[model samples]
Target: MALILSQLFISLILSLFFSLTLLPHATTSKANSSSEYSITSIFNVTAANHKTSQILSFKPFHNQEEFPQTFSSSSSFKLKLYPAASLYNTHHQHKNYYSLDLNASLNPGITTGTSNFLVQIGVGGPPQKFYMIFDLQTDFTWLQCQPCIKCYDQPDSIFDPSQSSSYTLLSCETKHCNLLPNSSCSDDGYCRYNITYKDGTNTEGVLINETVSFESSGWVDRVSLGCSNKNQGPFVGSDGTFGLGRGSLSFPSRINASSMSYCLVESKDGYSSSTLEFNSPPCSGSVKAKLLQNPKAENLYYVGLKGIKVGGEKIDVPNSTFTIDPYGNGGMIVSSSSLITMLENDTYNVVRDAFVAKTQHLERLKAFLQFDTCYNLSSNNTVELPILEFEVNDGKSWLLPKESYLYAVDKNGTFCFAFAPSKGSFSILGTLQQYGTRVTFDLVNSFVYLHTLCCN
Candidate 1:
């Protein structure tokens, strides 16, 4: 009996030693009490999936000269998408503008310097590669061109239109020029476009038609895009923006894509990439929701968000809380660029109160950034958080996993509810809540499908 006990004790000690050694080292402080938790330690407590944990642990790129490219298949074009943080070292310096300010009277476009997913494409005849922000809110594919009058610094080399034999400047008389909002005719007869975003990021230059090549999916000829000679903003680390909105000039509309789908892995690991598919079917067992349209902003994707539930119990909010007004001032939009979900003030208050009530037993911490509801989980070994569910069109419940709605704010086991209050009447379902889910947009049928944890 003594010999058997000794062997078991030795095995247990070895296991514990290995586990302790494997734990990631983190820097913590009691004074400020706002330390970033190591990826391993946060995952250990939250039980988050490996993909999400990898995202939290991503390190900035060391090489600026090398650009990453996406690959595709033949039947349906599939471009690989990478989180902006993984490809650019400058993403950390920009302020987080995850929520849209619709009251400013500016239409939604690229939210200043904060772009989330990026796609790489080749422009011109010989196909010079450029990294562009994949945006779903606007529909003008634009990039900074050579001989720029004024341009912001980008990681890739400025695209020289003279180098590509297939590049042709669009004339002011062309139909494509008429599609632009504030288009004009240049002195040289070329079509000129001037677009100013809500955050003051503007791009002005001649519109052109060029051959854009995609890996494995061949090339698209005569695609209408902007060759900006004057562009300025905090557009760090990317060459330009590739609009995938519902406008006539959007990439999807230009390509005549029947349906589009994307699986956001949300990993900033340099090697990891997510797939953005054009003309693809939703995965098996997808929860379907009807797509809502707003006349004011027809290009943006709006969904019917009827109500919200916490721990399987519905919150008492009026039906008008998430409705779009007559002038299209209020609604819910699923945005790929926004970092965190934003709810209108009234609706947000109800949701926050529900979470606060459930977590009353836990220790409260100072509000972190935009998060007002936060907790300290340092002493607890295992914690059970309430599951959040969104009731969309057709009464379908879109369930959010614990990791999707709750995030570790520090290395000291401090966590915060991942939501913010919007300044306007509208609410935005941002990318953080879409992680590990496959969101499919079926334009033909006007439906959106959600496949939870499909990427994992």
Candidate 2:
């Protein structure tokens, strides 16, 4: 049972997930072919003539102090999102994926916190590598195969499938075994699935279709995945959970990528290292937004905010508070495993009363869990504070500094407003409001850009 990023738990929202090692899909040739889009992997880098994207270099999950940082006494701090945060603990129920965030707070109590995004792929027909948990909200990609009965603990070894040679399984009349998500039809015909991971964890698995090479590029073949064999949750060091949703089996609609970029870099105690670019993005265009498409939370990525700013004023809010209803509930999302930012509660009390009327002599404190506003600052005060925008609806706005809405709680030395409110009306910008920034994600041209980092 794996697939997560309930990195948003904060009692407000932080969701994160993992619990994998999926693999089982085999058919070879064509991944939306035209010659597998002109072969190339390991991030080969190319743009003008296209067909050369296969960039890779993002691997940081060396435990990082285990995550899940929640406290209360020293004055207050909490990051619980599960039944009390969980990113590991599997050696009987099986858990060696101390990777992605179960609570994603390396230690937000102050310094080293929030991190999730590991990469390294290659599966079958002789390829092996693994690592996973890239998740743009998952679509279908799995691993943890081998002659097992109940697997787990996969840092390496376990993908065997008779040493690749283009492994296979799909059976039940292909079409990627009916796009598993609660599928069925086994008895030995294969295609069986079960899924279920918004944190309640679940997995039955069978759906196969291997051969997805990538050290940087080329080796498409067969693709479709999810060969769990057995799984639980937490997925520590990782072994599966890749998908970069939009459906059609994800991975940006099977490598069609008209766009893709990532850069969160800010490291130095969180020890950072990031990269996830495809199809040119060291910089480009610089402004764009309009991704909203929540088929009832299908992989998550909505937008259309339109309200926010402090320095220049403009806390008008209510454009339906960002609109999205039709039952999918008011929009807002950009969570790479959410770290903070959650608005929506009367638009966060009218943007926290317009930032407490511009810091009225700073002092407030008391609502711990979803942070009402929190405050402390004083030491050599100069305090100009103000300049915090978010307005997105063309007239453009995404700025927000002051360490992205504050947050220092040096064990109660105080300083937080890392932003939080939503009990659940949908709103989650997280990733600490996307630190250094630089997020592309064009999803074949439906929009999504957000700048700042140039590829750090």
Candidate 3:
């Protein structure tokens, strides 16, 4: 039977969103073991399959160069998280702006828009805790501050820079101010910025330098960030945005950390807060992959996706189907913001057919537009799912746990394959497939480490 798609898939294709955030500046676990980085913070992922207005087309600013190009690159950011860095500093001195969409409920019961995942962070000296979206795509970080000319209605008090003794304004001549995308000198001589988003959300305020802190790492001083005196847009839940991009201005790069990772906790209908570790070490039996760059979308994370293996058997598919184009087209992308893992049609079909065959015994259900393979297995039935092996060109293969690939749609035994086919040439290894695994984006070495994380 020819498969058809569903509203969920339609939404995945049409939906838009924003963000990324700080990885690790330090490290800490529940057992309180001192591991790699000095400072580490654990945040939560408000996992949900909420529906909203469909985003018709992906607006490319290079697009995802944040979601590292719209959630088809994380929709768009109010404080746009573009990858352009300060001219001089490719590492930390680059001119850039990034965003973090803290996953707080947006007018619950109203299907206007839906968001998932948020991380808790501390900003300023004697750091104030703020819950922000944990987006790993963009590089700019910001917070809604007081003395507001205009501000979004957030549950928490807007941060008052005046209350933080460590707050210091950036001068127009300062290297940090010079690095901002829309920074200018105010009449009063302080550096000012006006960040505009795709949906017309804008945050304008003074560029300031303050001490930002994390859990075990204590305080990192002179962190350049935005203190939005005037804020507007769909970002109405948390205090502000956080950067987790490749630009020098990104919190991870600024700290000069070698590596970091975020293990997305699976809490399918509800929010299960997870952890974000900076300078994280590789887990035992961890696999590695070289992090490639897409010239067409340089700001996003591009990796060499070799191919896939089903139940220890290699799926026969051409390498070019998963390759990065010389012109930088049609490469595979892995993003935490994107909800579905989209693959190029040719490759997806092969994987889909094999997956369906493996679970052929279970009673099949009508296809959800968003997912092609689905089954209505009884609660008491025991079916074995194929062990999905994702291969990276860097001589490593990452096995996706069952929870990462299969999703339960309802209280009954209705379940579906979480992977989807891309309408475009590229493929995205999205957050849905990333759950229950601890993966690290190694900044210094330009490699990624993947291993199963079963946090107690």
Candidate 4:
């Protein structure tokens, strides 16, 4: 009888194992009575043209407290922008772009680098939090998703779409799918997207419409974005990127925002936060400049840069050096990702020479990184820096603060000018130059408003 009992127990264990294998596999619990969607691996698709095989149903968030109602017309929200270095303990306090070995491949009027600012937002139905790079150069926002075949290591858990109740795949026939560059329809009729940055970083995945929630403004439904299953890059410490570009797939365009404003605080502590306001009115006493559009690259934010001034003396560079050609070759772009101001080679030479001439009394140091202008002022505490200004739109002088143009390399008073020459003819006015200022982009009026030293 004892031998028969042992045999019976073994038989029961085999039966249980088989039952568990036959049961449906799910990453998370079902939201409601609806059927749970199984996570589909990208490798399961046999067709050569097919990218992804997953299909998801749309269901509202069960927790109402996590996702509030849709935003009203006049309602506005603020997102805190933190320095990218704040997320990691080992990140260097000062990031000099010249030290980086960026990719040599070039794209038209586009350059990529390690983003300077990061913003946190919620994705999916239950509002899974994600830290993303807040970049103005990216046209489409994307994040790493589960079932990732190739993905970089991130601090947070990978976004699992199968677990989200509000995840919906976009069809190939939708107009939004057409907005993606080099997008194609999978064999299952789902829209697939692939984006490659100039820095050799790329992501490939299916287009999705998911719920995105902001901390102060509640949540927006069916926001179009990329759920990347295959991704590779050095994305700093962020999970993905939030694109604020003018493209149709950008966050501002997806939400139909008429205006947006961000104030970058001048702080090296990395933990200090700044504010990014959407649909906000221009700040009082702000100077307005006519925003220019590059027909070839409409997603970029271009402003008329008439000239540059050092110590109140305008540099003697041809005005055409800053003008955009008909083919959209040369133009000035206000970039939030770039840490240092970059100008065309000839234009930069003139500006650098003018700065050197004005600071002749200060002792000069060897060129540090890409910066040709470095000064050793170890003994001086109150040395006056040359006032730097940019002439924009009909001769409006936008004065730059001292911290914008000067960077202290070390504690011993080795300072370097915070400017560089662009790889191409196009110039970029980076965040370093815009610090301690409020930058407002009025899309409806096609204007950019600048308020100096207004960030508190």
- Top candidate on TM-score is 1
Candidate 4 per-residue lDDT, tens place, 318-359, comes to 666667888888778888756678888888888898888877
Q: After superposing candidate 2 on the true structure, give the runs of residues whose Cα lies further than 4 Å from its correct spot.
A: 1-84, 90-134, 148-168, 171-224, 228-244, 250-302, 315-333, 338-357, 360-409, 416-428, 431-456
Model 2, range 29-99, lDDT digits (tens) per residue? 32211111221111111120011011012122333232112211211111111111222333334433323
Give lDDT per model, in order.
0.68, 0.54, 0.57, 0.67
Q: Which ten residues in a row have the lowest lDDT in candidate 4?
A: 48-57
Give the Cα-based TM-score of candidate 1 against the true structure. 0.81
| Candidate 3: regions farther than 4 A off | 1-115, 267-273, 393-396, 454-456
Clashes of each: 1, 54, 46, 0
**Distance (Å) between predicted and true CA of 204, model 3?**
2.2
Q: Candidate 4 has what TM-score?
A: 0.79
Tell how far residue 394 is off in model 1, in angstroms: 4.6
Answer with 1 or 2, whichever has the higher lDDT: 1
Better of 2 and 3 by lDDT: 3
* RMSD values, in order shown: 11.9, 22.3, 13.7, 20.9
Lowest lDDT 10-residue stretch of candidate 3 = 64-73
The superposed Cα distance between candidate 1 and the true structure at residue 87, in angstroms, equals: 0.8
Candidate 2 matches the true fold with a TM-score of: 0.32
Model 4: CA > 4 A from native: 1-74, 89-113
Clashing residue pairs, backbone N/CA/C < 3 A, model 1: 37-411
Residue-level error in angstroms, candidate 4, position 454: 2.7
- lDDT, candidate 1, equals 0.68
- Angstrom error of the Cα, residue 90, model 4: value is 5.9
